[model samples]
Target: MRELSFHGVTVRFGAGRSALAAVDGVDLTVPAGSVVGLVGESGSGKSTLAKAAVGLVPTTDGEIRLDGAPLRARRDRRRLQMVFQDPYASLDPRMTIGASIAEAVPGRPGRTGRAAEVARLLELVDLDPSRAGSLPSGLSGGQRQRVALARALAAEPDVVLADEITSALDVSVQGSVLNLVRDLRRQLGLTMLFISHNLAVVRYVSDVIAVMYLGRIVEAGPAAEVLTSPRHPYTRTLLDAAPRFGVALDDPVPADSELLDDEPPSPHDPPPGCRFHRRCPIGPLTVPERTVCVEKDPQPAAADRPHRAACHFASDAAPASLEVPAR
Candidate 1:
């Protein structure tokens, strides 16, 4: 497994005054042989950061390293492969699953004996090798995603980027796929970056979780610690909005706790100070806190060992229970 590192990574779209920083000066690392989950809402730059790692998108600033070597200069591009969200779009419509998987086997392009390798990959993903001849269109959504994962592994990638690969599948299918990924990581010691908006899914599959807001990471820590006792307010807000395991069904939802109505400020010219200040539920309540929030951007600082948050009022204490009794 290769350690993937992003140092001050920044990706921009368009140019000049209209330029938008899709991924702002972000520093992240996916430790060798561990899965790191990047969780956030849409447009939070999760996908862009993943794409940037494999050189699919250019980084306007910073650098990406694979096991301490520059990602681009490395001769073997197959060491880092991505499994995208859309299985159908990622696969070749006309190609058989076997052929697709075999084609990705590094240094063996169009060579004989690929059938054996293809069958092994199929088994690795828990798919029947007999179905390898089936076209992508003939397979179920879950099966197609497995095929995509198998194809990515055929290259023997040291780091795999699984970007919302199960989002489009049924809940049952999603569980199966996630289980397969978790099992594979344990068995093969595969390093991965798992991106998704579902906090539950992220918690299940990741050892570490990073919460992104706008183009910055607001919180990052051990999956259990961050998910269960989120330090950042944005992390707490997300947990409240999602269907948590401990949240009671009869709990009264706070009327004032809904997300901000306005869309996030444009990344082209992000809001000054805390990018989340406009939507921060706690910031506006106090004068001094509001002043710090509106006047200065909070840098990610250590909250605990291996845990960090970029909030002025971050806490180590577990947040209050979201299960409020109905009035």
Candidate 2:
């Protein structure tokens, strides 16, 4: 089932700083009943892609289609739900958890039979119905996030776009929430676009992976292949950062937060040639990879199969940076 597809999607704030021109030409397809993980740093455009997928943000260029229908084509909105990182903010401080969920359901008047529906939704997310009466302020971080999940499901959606959904939950509860989502996806066969900066988290839940940089996908492939033998330079760096991701970046000596290049360029006004030329670590690689990489742009089909990368040298480039330990 073609749940979602983006053809040559590009997002530019305007024409000046080159932020997303790096991703000028991108094609994304989310097959039905599969989890596609979109991974990148804070400004890598991962979240922007997520927001666009669910119609939370508009795309500056290109087209986004859901179930082969244009996403902008008056979607029911509830059909494709989003689970935000801040669970508390997604919920209302004044409204009860039960009412919050009921609002997502169509044509539901008042709280009639809402108690049972709330209970069922809570159970769906491994929460207790008794807690439905409680406000988001009364719930723990994990519980609040769980409530967020339940609320997303309240819409009875066939597809879910989870943007850093578990970032705020306790490590202990992270597994359970991920498990719940996995279980639901398996049982309900829901299609999901799981956006996250955590490589491990993305690896744990995704069937396939799409690594983003600037505003384009640098590498994409089966999760196992991409994680085990990453190809792109950005992919390796991100993996290297993963081992120490838990460390407060501010406290880290050099700080992983350092811009790979400079200013990340402006999404509005990008540079000439490869948008990543300024930051691409591999000095100058092979023909297609390097020639266009820094001065031009790269197509995402450099790899042999599922492991497609945008770098010109990505095909022959060895994994020099991130090497997982032998377990």
Candidate 3:
């Protein structure tokens, strides 16, 4: 496994003043043989960041490095593979499962060798090797996802970018796919960036967690620490919104609590200073005296810090002052 690092990476669409910053100047690292879960809302740039790493999207500035070396060429990029969310769309309906896996294998392994390799990959993913001849249309949703994972592994990639790989599956199937992810990481020592909107799923498969809001990673740290004691207001809100087993959907929300229902500011013309201030529960919108969040952007914590939050009030008593009502 290889370490993947992004340094001040910025991805912008359009040109000049009309450009939309899908991924702002962000710095993150996926340590070798470890899983770093990237969690956020739908338009928070989690998917965009994954696409940028695999060269599916263009980055305006900064660098992407694998094992500390810059990825400037196409072949170098092949080592960083991605497993997209939709398994049905990712695979070809006409191709057999074995044929799909074989397409990603490097070099000319010849006919017999290729078949053996394909069968091995099928078995690796807990699918019957005999079903290699079956088309994607014949498999279940979870099985197709396993095939997608098998195809990514066929490339022998150093780092895998899994972009919401479980969102489309049924609740029961979601657990199987998630278990496969954990098993793959342990058995293959895979280094991965797992992106998801579900904090519960992320907490299950992640070693570290990074929470993104409107393209910037607002908080990141060890999974246990980030989930149990989140430093950022956005992170706390996400944890609160996550569905608990006993909690009913119709449970009344506190009148004093500010929900995340407010739409985020447009990325095309992001507001000055902290972008989250408009929707921040404890920001200037709630506390009239805290104008700093509206006037100046809060710098992220130093890279060396174990647990970091990009909020000026993270270390202060702000979180204590405005308690988010418990579910």
Highest TM-score among the candidates is held by which one? 3
How far in Å is the alpha carbon of 96 misplaced in model 2?
A: 0.5
Whole-model lDDT per candidate: 0.83, 0.74, 0.87
Global lDDT for candidate 3?
A: 0.87
Task: Give lDDT tens digits, candidate 1, residues 1-327.
Answer: 989998889999999998889999888889999999999989999999999888788999998888888877645556899999999999999999999998888775444578888988999999999998999999999999999999999989989999999899999999999999999999999999999998888988999999998988878888888877787777776776677577785454421344354577877778877887776655653234358787887864534423577777675334663222222
Mind giving the per-residue lDDT tens digits that candidate 3 earns over 227-277? 777777778778767777987755543222554577888888888777777
lDDT string, candidate 2, 68-184, tens digits: 777665454557888999999999999999889887776665566777788888988888888888999998988898888888888788678899988888889888888988898
Model 3 ranges with Cα > 4 A deviation: 246-256, 300-306, 317-327
lDDT of 2 at 327: 21
Q: Name the regions of candidate 2 deviating beyond 4 angstroms.
A: 15-23, 109-112, 244-271, 285-292, 300-306, 318-327
Candidate topping lDDT: 3
**What's the residue-level lDDT of 258 in candidate 2?**
38
Summed over model 2, clashes come to: 16
* Ranking according to TM-score, highest score first: 3, 1, 2
* Backbone clashes in model 3, listed as residue pairs: none
- lDDT-better candidate, 1 vs 2: 1
